[model samples]
Target: METLHEIPALRARLADWRDNGLRIGLVPTMGNLHDGHLALVEAARARADRVVATVFVNPLQFGPHEDLDSYPRTLNDDARRLSRCGCHLLFAPSEAAMYPHGRDAHTVVEVPGLSAQLCGASRPGHFRGVTTVVAKLFNLVQPDLAVFGQKDYQQLMLIRRMAADLCMDIEILGLPTVREPDGLAMSSRNGYLTPAERARAPALFRTLQELAAWVAAGTPPAQAERDAAQALSVAGFEPDYLSVRRRADLAPAGPQDTALVVLAAAHLGRARLIDNLELDRIVAEAH
Candidate 1:
């Protein structure tokens, strides 16, 4: 696979594929790839004739206090993984290429109400940064299909909402969150965990599972959320948020809401991890 840095060079290669009438797929990422990211490439390859994966560490998406500087970058290994996995092209652009006029000067794209809720509420302007850079990627690649992991369920939903509202025709596909032998969600941030913290990481997913059980057993959503947060705290985590919400739009889940997802974000030492469990609507509404 060819790795191109400049936008024009990347566009030129895509044009040749377009000329051949080949369908295109996209998988975007911040470098430091793992098996979970490779799964996204595999998902895209299954749906399209050629896959275009992008590794751009979006400055827009990182809050000032977030780990933008310390975030891992393994471009060489990332390219190797993509090539071995059958990716057609890899676009790894520099910060300047993505934001020639600088991040502060670039136009922002916000998705109104949904952009400021849930995960958005904690990380102020985080989803705004996400939507803007993703909108920019959509404009640049114009791929027929784009694949993302459901691990960041809110992000998957946000990008879908943004594309639909903006009327972009690309298909947004969400694959299941890949996990280790233990239930902890696979993330680049998982690298930050100390040995002891890593051993404790699985508790986050277990807590989310317990929360889902409580809601399924006719418990109030708010009560279950509080119980889950307390459990995480007792397990040695600084809880961020653990709430039940309608998976469709992430509005707080009502008593009888059919489509539901239980999501959690919490701090464990230096690493902040997020994970979720999508509920069976039939089970959640049974009571």
Candidate 2:
């Protein structure tokens, strides 16, 4: 696979591929790749003729007190993994190359209501950073399709919405969240978990699952959130938020729809973990 660090070089290679009738697929990541990221590449490869994975630890999305300074950047290992996955191109751009004059009069991309809730509430300008960087990557790569992990469900939804609203001529695909044997969602941030914290992390997923079961059994959404928050507290986590909302519009769950999602985020020591579970409509019937 060819590796290009500069945007122009990467765009030139992508142009050549387009001219040759090769369908381009792009996977944008913040480096520190794991199985979840590779899954995206595999999905991209399946959908298009050429796959390009861009690894830039974007600074725009990170808040002031966030882990941006310590965010893992395993470039060598990431490259090796992408190579094994048969990725055709890898674009790893520097912060300066990406921002040039540093976040100047750039047109910010924000998906109105969606960015103001859930992770949006906690991270402040997180989604703004996400949408802006993703827009930049889309413009730079110009792939026929882009693959994102469903683990960041809100982010994925916003990206899909942004692409559509902005008239981006590319398909946005969100693959399923990859998990560990113990049920913790696989994330690059998982690397920061201390040994003891890592062992306790799966409790987040367990709490989410238990709450989802309650919601499926006709429990009030508020009560379900309360119980999940308690479970997370009992598991030694500092509960950030535990909410049950209609998965379709991300609105609070109501009597009209049987399908719901139980989403939770918490502080397990210094690492902030997030997990969610979807309840199928048939789940209500079974209960």
Candidate 3:
């Protein structure tokens, strides 16, 4: 696949594709390619005539103490994987290319209420960075549709909200979270886990799954949330938040809510893993 490192070159190529009446799909990511990321590229390939995969490790989304410097970069390896997955173009820009004016003066985008809870509470300014970079990518790529992984469910929701709120005429699609055989959600950060930690990491997903079962069985949502957090602790994780919320707005689920999700985040050794399970069908089955 063709790789473009500069914005002008990438935009020119996209313009040419648009002129030729080809629908474009975008899959934005930080390198360190894995099966999950390739799945996103494949999803894009299915929906659009041409697919563009971006591999820039966004500094904006990372907090000061976070692993910005150490985050893996495997552009060459990632490009090979993307090409195999049927991606048409790869955009791997430098930090300066993304933030030409320097981060201090760069314009920021925020989604308000959605950005202030869960992961946001732990990483201040994180979503601001996410929204801003994603906005910039949306502008630069200008794809008709973009694909994001549901593993970052909150980010997906926020991006959809941002695109609509800002009047961007692009479809945002969230694919299902890819997982390992043992139930661990596939993540680039999963590499940070040691062998011992890796064995225990699957508990995070298992906890969420059990929590889903409890909620399905008519357990109180608040109690289920607390139980999930406690289960993570018992599994040797430092629980961050385990919540059940309405799938639409991510607000706490109410008695009348039909569609719901169980979301959790926890620290396992050096890696922080986040995962969620949609419980709408489970609740429906219970009824």
For candidate 1, what is the total of clashing residue pairs?
A: 0
Over 4 Å off, model 3: 281-287
Candidate 1 versus truth, CA RMSD in Å, comes to 1.6
lDDT for residue 177 in candidate 2, whole number 0-100: 89
In candidate 2, list every pair of residues with a backbone clash: none
Q: In candidate 1, what are the lDDT values of residues 53-160, reduced to their tens digit?
A: 999989898899999999999999999999999999999999899999998999999998987877899999999999999999999999999999999999999999
lDDT of 2 by residue, 1-287 (tens): 88899988987898899899999999999889999999999999999999999999888888988988899889999999999999999899988898877765556788899999999999998999999999988998888999998888888889998999999999999888899999999988888889999999999998888888777777877988898898889889999999888888788887667777778889998889988888854433434
Q: How much lDDT does each candidate structure score?
A: 0.93, 0.89, 0.92
Candidate 3 per-residue C-alpha lDDT over 114-228 given as tens digits, one digit per residue, 9 for 90 to 100: 9999999999999999999999999998999999999999999999999999999999999999999999999999999999999999999989999988988888899999988
lDDT of 3: 0.92
TM-score of 1: 0.97
Scored against the true structure, residue 193 in model 2 reaches a CA lDDT of 88
Score every model by TM-score: 0.97, 0.96, 0.96
